[model samples]
Target chain A: MCGIVGLHLRDPALYPRLGELLTGMLCEMSERGADSAGVAVYGDPVWSPPGHATVTVIGAVPDLPDVTVISLGETHVVHAPVPVDALVAAIRAQLPDALIAGFGEELTVLKGVGHPRELAATFGLAKAQGWQGVGHTRMATESAVTPEGAHPYAVGPDQCLVHNGSFANHATIRRHLTARGVVFDSENDTEVGARYVASALADGRDIESALKSLCAEFDGFYTLLVSNRDSFAVVRDAIACKPAVIAETDAWVAMASEYRALVGLPGIEQARIYEPEPERIYAWTR
Target chain B: MDSMTIVMDKGVNRTLHRLDAGSVTITEPNGKHSVAVGLNAPLQVSIEGHCGYYAAGMNQLADVVINGNAGVGVAENMMSGSVRVNGNASQSAGATAHGGLLVITGDAAARCGISMKGVDIVVGGSIGHMSAFMAQAGRLVVRGDAGEALGDSIYEARLYVRGKVASLGADCIAKDMRDEHHAELRSLLAKAGYDDDPADYTRYGSARQLYHFHAGNEY
Candidate 1:
């Protein structure tokens, strides 16, 4: 079992409170999954500065003086003044073995092994400002209990995906994707799900069609929360064994594995709360 | 009547652990998972807000009510007692429940009452596709429309639908509405706070075909 929480702010005024609210939501899910926690914050200016590309590399890295480096434990964020391709080349040349979990123009994915509350604090999430954030607390069913196995597996540009249950045909799909030259970072089943969405979006499929394709191809239980630069979406499998709830207000759209993760949001009582229908795509845009 | 109220925050164990016996009122439920599970004492639990998965799983001798929407598995494997969802319920609303009265005031999503053994489920609104799949024994009453593939692979369990049925599952055939069924459905509707005439409903059950799979049987 794992816990996934996401918040997409429709009002610009609520951006500053994104991290604080998300931290509470993640911490509340500590009991559901205690092994590790991860989060992807969108539109964090310092982490993903305007016009610059950002890369999230797992583990410590030798500082490249030209880029702005922010270290949170072993996780490192390199915000380069140049485009994303240039940053990718520099990282490949400097630290070839460093696992780049995600690189994007508007997202910064940070993760670590510990209680979600402490990880949120260590990553400076409370101070981070973003229009959207997605977090996960993983119990490590499909893969090892490593930080890389933890979720908010942001594989594609400005894309983030977190999952709560196991995928049955992930290995088969993984082999299929690998044959097609999609390099993977971890053995986690959720990583396969993220790669599938990334590949779908890369192929020019819209969010709804990509999610529908996921329902057609994958098997087993899953409740997925996916976020991109301008959209937030959620979808469940046919069985929908995993739990997910969504609450939408004029200011924001929030989703969590359970209701407790959502209760802390401001004006929650006024929000239109409901569970996403199984095999149905619920997507919202900025 | 005197009632004990427990305020639940993020912790689920603590909230359920406190309900030893008697009437209980739970406020600020905040969608915690597995609330009020395995309760043997006769009691009534009123959750003031939304709830998460398995809100009253494996319950016994208790009536649990949710004021807002419920996540998946609202009353999974319930042995006895009743669960009332004031708002909508997600998939598997009464999955594998053995004995219970589960009432959903709002719609129930896909696979509601899946694998139900002996529970009685009544939905105020529509139920999604493939509901009551592989149900062994129970009674499902849908006041509103039922989605595609209702009561697939159904066993002795009886299904009653007031609105249109999108389709019936394998071996599940619509039967004539009998007088005895109307009396039973009327009692269930009354228990679920509905006074609709049971005569307006249709009855469905397993055809006893495909009980034992022959070679090349189409599932």
Candidate 2:
């Protein structure tokens, strides 16, 4: 079980209101899953820090330095201008189990084993600025509960996603995606959708076509929500074994696992809420 | 009489949500199987709309009322209490009835009262085929036509149909309806608001012949 929420604000000025609504939705939807929570907000800055953050890890620090290497054996210092590959290699060299998932120019993702509340405190999620994104709260039914199992998983540059349901042909799909240089870090079926969609787009398939192709190939229950800096998409599986509510107004479009979360939103009374039809796609831009 | 209320969804019936307190009025609110299966309360329930499948199975102490068409097994294993249907009833109206009363205001489908033990069943319309297959006890009084195999393997149960008897059960024959039976049939008809003539019927029962299931049984 998991809860996924997405919002595409047609009105750019409602950043604060959207943030409040998004937070409330995440907390409320957390009831479906309490393993982890993360949101990728678009176009709004909680407190703009930098265009990029360099989280450096030093190997076996014999001595502590006051410089950027202020952290001990393994450190996650949100520094600027650090190379991505060098940082990943350094962290992997020290802690081979290290996983570095990044998003957008400024917003970064850091997850570990804990509840949403605890992870939020550790990741300083409240301080992360808004970018177009999807949020996830995991229940860990088929997948393990670790940082790798956490979601809003980056499928591409500045891309993240959350999903509910299992893929019937997960192993076969994973094999096909693995052959295309798509990395598989977790055993979550939702991640297979992400990898396939991301690989399709990287091969010049547009987001719409990529999503359609993914649905055509995959079978089972799913309500997938994905977002990047420019676009967001929500797809209902063929059977609709999971629940997804879509509430839309001229100003904003919101998706949540249930209507109760949306009811607490600021403009909910003005929107129309409904269940997404089977095998349907709902996407928006800017 | 206490009461019970139940809410139903479409295509779902056979539900008798617990009864508590005096006579209850159940508003169907559009659902099927709203009241059925093992009603054991000492209350009364009045369903407001159509019901589906086993409206009152194994009814013990509660009185049941269906305002619309009843699906299969309207009152299957009634042990006590009373079931009154305002509309037509489907097959197995009171199969294996042990006690209590089943009153149908309109027509009844096949197997109106099969294997009746001790309960009394009253139907206001025509009964269909294979009714009262192997009745062991109780009485079935029909105010209308009866189809073929009216009482296929009759035992000790008594049957009275107000119309033509298409057939009969093994070692079974028609008997004369006495004064006491007339009084009881009239009371049941009156309860379901029927005013049909009771004289144009025939009574059927076992001769205690095949109650032991003879090896060489014949139709």
Candidate 3:
């Protein structure tokens, strides 16, 4: 089981309160799964800057002196370590968005293995501000508990995906992706989902079609929250055994495993709240 | 006049934990999961907004009224009392519930009353597929159409539908509505606050042929 929280802001007035609101949303779901946690924040100028590229590595950085290394919002960052030649190859491999941190034009993915609340505090999420944010609290069922196993698997450029249930056919799909030369970082099932979306986007598939393809490819119960540079989307399996709730107001669009995570948002009382339909993709763009 | 009012903005666990036998008002429910779970008192819970999964689960003698939409499995495994949803409800509206009167003013989605054991469910609008599967006893009244596989693998439970049924599950068949059935249906409709005549509905029940296995039956 896992808990996922995401916010797509519509009103610029609430931008400054992004981190604080997301922090409250994330912490309210700590009871769902406390094992590990991760988050992906978009539009943070200091973390990703406007032009220069960024990447988030799992462990200590490798020896590369030309790239400047910096840390922001408690998330470790290093300037583009990929040799110009390797960067293309890395993209070809469909590297995860969480692992790379900086994706596309701007994104910052921070992940850690610990209680969600503690990790959120350590990552300084209470003060981070962004146009979009996605957080996850994990309880390992198909994989081991490690930093790499934590979620917000943003494999696509400026894209992030967090899942609440297991995929039964991930191993088979992983094999297919591997045959097509998609190298994976962890054995986690959610990573397979992330890679699937990244692969689709790499081939120029739009977010809606990419998710529809996922509904046709992967099998199992799942409620997935996916976000990119311009859009936030949600989907569920055919049976929709997993739980998910979505609320949208003129100011923002929010989703979580349960409704408690959404109580902190502004205008929640007036928001249009509903559960996403099974096998249907619901996407909102900034 | 009032027992206590609990606000459920933070989470459902703490608010439901403090409920007692009195009039309780829940404000800003915001679709929180498991609201008013496992209540065993003669309490009245009025949820001011939409609520998430398992609202009033395992309830006994509690009257739960959701002012907005209700998520999945509302009144799950409820033993007694009533659960009323003013808006639409998601899947498994009264899954495995033992006894209670669950009324949904709007439509109820898939698997409504699945595995129901002696619970009475009244839906003002349509109900989705596989409803009342393995229902041991009780009545299900739908004012609108029923989806595919209605009452699949059903047991002694009674089903009444005022509109079309897309399909019926194995061993479930339509039965003639007698005077007693009309009276019972009238009472159920009255309890659910619908003024429609019970004679407009059709009754369905298990065929009883599936009770014993045949030598070459495909089943």
Which residue runs of candidate 3 sit more than 4 Å off their true CA positions? Answer: A62-68, A72-75, A79-102, B1-22, B26-41, B50-53, B144-148, B161-183, B197-204, B207-209
- Docking category for candidate 1? medium
Choose 2 or 3, whichever is better by lDDT. 3
> What's the distance in Å from true for residue B157, model 3?
2.0
- Candidate 1 TM-score, true structure as reference: 0.91
Top candidate on lDDT is 1
Sort by TM-score, best first: 1, 3, 2
lDDT of 3 by residue, B1-219 (tens): 466666785555465556566688888776677888888777888888888789888989889899988888999999999999998888999999999899999888778999899999999999877888887899999999998789888999999999999899988899999999999999999999998988899999999888899878775
> Candidate 1 chain A — worst ten consecutive residues by lDDT sum?
A237-246
Models 1 onward score TM values of 0.91, 0.53, 0.87
Each model's DockQ score: 0.61, 0.02, 0.55
Please give the RMSD to the true structure for each candidate, in Å: 3.0, 15.5, 3.9
- List ranges where model 1 is wrong by over 4 Å: B9-22, B77-80, B212-219
Q: Candidate 2 docking category?
A: incorrect
Tens-digit lDDT string for candidate 1 (A212-280): 999999999999999998899999987666878888999999998887888899999999887787789
Clashing pairs in 1: A259-B30, A259-B31, A260-B30
Report the TM-score of candidate 3, chain A only. Answer: 0.90
Please say which candidate is ahead in DockQ: 1 or 2. Answer: 1
